[model samples]
Target: MPFTLYMLALAVFAQGTSEFMLSGLIPDIAADLQVSIPAAGALTSAFAAGMVVGAPLMALLSRRWPRRRALLVFLIVFLLVHVVGAVTTDFGVLLATRVVAALANAGFLAVALATAAAMAAPGATGRATSVLLGGTTLACIVGVPAGAVLGQEWGWRSAFWAVAAVSVPAVIAIMASVPGGPAGAGARGAGGELRALRRPRLLVALLLGALVNGATFCTFTYLAPLVTGVTGFGAAGVPVVLALFGLGSFVGVTAGGRLADRRPRPLLAVGGAALLVGWVVFALTAGNAAATVVLVLVQGTLSFAVGSTLIAQVLYAAVEAPTLGGGFATAALNVGAAAGPWWGGVALAAGFGYRAPLWVSALLVAVALAVGGAAEGVRVRRRAAGGAGEAPAPAR
Candidate 1:
């Protein structure tokens, strides 16, 4: 892998820390803001909503610019928003800041994915994309737990301030290391890229991405509550369980990278099934501390294992427009992210217990599994009609 790739991952680590750390901060935020826990959970949805809008919009705006410059612009905006979020006392102001920060986060991640794909050696796009996304998994391991500790010891605002501080060096690293070149210089214009998204295969893949993320976030957004309320842990134990989840995610992403380019379809099927099983077991065993801990690890691994393959599948489906392809994937996934927590909140309001979200997750994953299977069948049929064998194609 290139040094630039790792630098891009570092930047992603900064943004991802802010994104996932909110899960751990929800209880503290609710207590400080004088809002219900469900209301505090809406902050995650608000951030995801911004990403749903920002991904394609930023991709269009930055289509012609050099990748490094675009990334820097987004990172600076993200850092500033975090600063604003750190200092704000008003709940509305804090929520608005999350939206703005998410815009920057979405823009940066879309371009980073496109840039990483462009920089990869032949047949290594899946590996390159996974390596970039590994930052998020690493954030789960280190940043999320650290933020939880900071929130518990100091205040939730301190966590945002910490992210802002870390982002300064991340910005400098990207500026110094990433090459100042237009990524996918020959790629289609915004209009042409939009046209590419009209393909059924690409659309299905994008939807699948959304469903997969929705499934994960439905329960994950409320994981702090689940740990403390349902799993019989104290507030301090939240970070430990979250760290276990992150460890599983790190392992999953690593394995997914190695397999995605080789067997994306089968990987998606198997991973989706495993994730569904994990959710079912989680719902059934929510009251058992040991079972919940083990299932959290299993769920994390299964959920992330499909991530790289899903992204690669979308990229393959939209080979003519790599930047827009990446943006579409980002937007679709975040749409699910936004919806999942909102739906989970609804379940809570409807008098379902904390474990209800796991059932929601399971259903979402089931739908994703079916969609993935259909997409794979389509791909196989197309290949056969064109006289191609069942062998996987080399990554572009």
Candidate 2:
């Protein structure tokens, strides 16, 4: 991997920290802004909505620009929004700021993934992507918890300030490290890219990415409640369980990247199956603390393992327009992020227990496996029809 890849990863870590820090600050924000907790929770949803919109919008706007320049511009805007968010006391203004910041975050990630894919040596796109995504997993482990502590000790505003402060070095690193050139410059315009999205196989790949993430978040969004209410753990232990999940995610992505490069189809099928099994087992044994903890680790690992492969699959499907491909993947994943929790909330409202989300998650993963199988079958048939003389499509 190149040093520039690490720089991209660092930038992702900063933005990811800002994105997820809101989860821990919702209570403080609600009290400070004189709003309900559910209202404050909307801030998180707002951010995901912004990502869903911003990914393609930013990709189209920056399609002609150098990748490095696009990344720098996005990071600058992200920093500015965090500064504004830190000073805003009005809930509406703060919510608006979250959306704006997420736009910048989404833009940065879209460009960075394309740039990373373009920069990697032959057959190493999956590894490069995994390296980039490692930053986000690290944030879940380190940055989010630290931000929560900062919010609790100093105030919620302090967490925004911390995000802004940390972003400064990421901006400088990108300026110094990332090469300036029209990377992915051959990508088609917005119209052509949109047409590509209409393709059935490409759509399936994108949907697979969404379903994989949706399944993960469906259970994960309610994990704290499940840990305390079902497993009988104390409040203080919630962070520990989350950290364990993050650790598993980090390991899974690292391993999944290598496996994806070698065999994306098998990894996708096996990872999805593991996730489905993990969720079913979790739902059944959630009352046992030890079983719950182990299942959490398994779920985290399988979810991320599948996620990385799905991303690689999408990238391969949209190889002709890498930046737009990345944008599509990001948008699909964010849509899942927003939808999964909403569905889980609906289940909870209908009087399902905390474990209900796990069952829902299992169903989602099973759907993903079916879609993935369909995709694989299509690829194999296409290869067979072309005869043995023609090369098969990439495993993704």
Candidate 3:
């Protein structure tokens, strides 16, 4: 909750807008670039791949640099990439820009998360994490909607300009607010730190995190076209639909943060189960305009509520590996981010229609819930054999 954290969040909002606004612009991008909608949707996957691959690479390469300087350099790269993206005519060039911008975004996010944690007043790292993540949640509300409207009024290229424009203010804030100190105490040896990935709990947490988000992007990535084409809402209604989802997301993260620390297992299991049911209901009733609209709000709330809590579980599970924790959790979510759109696109290409992704989403949620159940079952059996009342596991 520091002012500097807020500034970092502001910067994240700028980059995150570029990261997420493409969802709303998929149709326009496909039309302008003369590609199929599925091809256009792959851009989301490319960006996510960049995040998954680049966060750790960049973190390792820049480990010795001053925090403030690294942030500015990353933001500048981000801004330039958006500019390149705005002017590019070829889909290939635009696609490259998405990957590059995501790399820069990932680098900045990794650094900012470290900075936020380093600055937090003892045991408040979770709040700091939430404060930083709040930027992306906010981006979904303000920046993503504005991008859709801009794409509607002017063109999809203008949304890229908006991302670049927003970066200027964030750049100013980083220069003024962040300290010039080093990233943190130098990280421990590679083998010692790398061992954190071996934990069964961490691995499960990572997989569940990925599945939860995959379920979401399966439906969300194509919302623009889905609402316009399948639900009988006009193209102009796309942004409103997105805004409702964003509003629900805002509610979700707020509620999840309050309960996750105290009741993570129940929260993710029940919330994900609820989302599974919601997706089924949504697919069955999507033809009804009123039901579709109401379901968007309900599904959005359930998805983010569980999604946010699962992320927290991954973070807690990886507490021993400070350096790798953020990158791994990030990779987990972006794995879903990359996979969801590609699979959703596959369904579309195979003649499954817009509703196919909903079924895919429901299946992903069920898989995650089953994994959680099996893990819990093993833990229960082990505890009973070990003679009850064992100290609770670190991540639970």
Candidate 4:
């Protein structure tokens, strides 16, 4: 592990903290802004929407820039956005700040992952990406809890301010550690990158990414309610349970990285299957508190554990276009994050049982597995056909 990877990892930590701290502070924000909880929740949605919209836009624009320079610029923008978010008075101003912050976040992450891989040893890309992504998982485990405590003691504004403060050291470290060079000369240039993206196999991989994430989040968005309401936990216990879920995610991401390095395809298949099992367990055990707790841990673990493998799959699927392909995969994940909660909310409004979201999520996971299987089959068939054509040409 290069020292710079750790620096890049710190930048990711700051961005992840900013993105997730909102969930813990939403109630505080609702109270301070004189808005309903649902309205405050929209702030999170706004951020996700911005990420989905801004990632590709930023990637395309920065396609010609050095990866290190791109990372620095994005982090600076992210820091500024957080400062604006901390001080904004009106709900509309806060919303705008959130959007800009999310844009910076999306750009920063997309570039950072690429930079990490660039700096890593050959065959260490999976571990490198995992290390950077572990920052996000760590944010859930450490940052969110700290932010929640800060929000409770100080105020919601304090949480945002705290995140901004963290970014100071991150920006400094990023500047000192990451190197700058000309872009698009890495492995392949922009034209070659774009050409690789045109492959059908890569598109199939992105579709699979979008589906898996969308379904996982659909179940996750309502986890607190299901825990408290259906599982018969008190409000006070919900946070504790959620904290456990976060810890599970932290473990999952790290473990998944190791397994992915060993076996990418089978690990992904196992992850998808585990997610399906989690949903089924959640649906079946919602009325049993002990079982529900166990299932929630699995749910969070499976949802996040496959993150590294998924990125590896996407990059491999589009190895011809590493940076752009990874960026698009991340953008798809953000799209799912934004859409999934909305989908779950609809299920709730339709008077579905508390466990309905889990069942629906299970159904989507099954679909994702089927799509992945189809994509893999396509790759194998194409390889076989190429071999056959080569045999005949050699004979001729």
lDDT for model 4: 0.75
- Candidate 4 residue-wise lDDT, 1-396, digit = tens: 887787777777777788878888898898888889999998988888888988877766676788778887888888887778788778888988889888888877777767766776766677787788888878877888899889989888888888878878867776787777643436477677877777766666676667777876787678788887898899998777877777777777777777766676777778888888878877987999888778777777887776556775566655556567767877988777767677778888899977878877888788878877776675567678774211000010
lDDT of 3 by residue, 98-142 (tens): 898888888788778777666776555555676777788789999
- What is the C-alpha RMSD, rounded to one decimal, of candidate 1? 3.0
| Pairwise TM-score winner, candidates 2 and 4 | 2
- lDDT digits (tens) for residues 1-396 of candidate 1: 988788788878888899888877999899988999999988987887788999988877887789889899999999998998888778999889989888889888888888888888867788888898899989989988789889989999999999888888868877887878875577877778789788777787788888888988788788989888898999889878878888888888888888887888678877888888889999999999999999998888878888667877777766778777888889988888878877888998899899889999998999888776766676678777994422222234
Candidate 2: regions farther than 4 A off: 387-396
Off by over 4 Å in 1: 23-43, 87-95, 152-154, 382-396
Give per-residue lDDT, candidate 3, residue 128.
Answer: 67
lDDT winner between candidates 3 and 4: 3
lDDT of 1: 0.83
* Ranking according to lDDT, highest score first: 2, 1, 3, 4
TM-score of each model, paired residue for residue: 0.89, 0.95, 0.85, 0.92
lDDT of 1 at 352: 88
Encode model 2's per-residue lDDT on 1-396: one tens digit a residue. Answer: 988888778878888898888889999999999999999999988898899999988877777788779999999999998899889878999999989988888888888888888888878888998999999889988999999999999999999988888888878878887878774666677687778666666688788888878988888789999999999999999999999888888888889889878887677776778788888999999999999889888788888888987787677667777888888889998888878888888899999999889888888888878877776676678778883321112433
lDDT of each: 0.83, 0.84, 0.79, 0.75
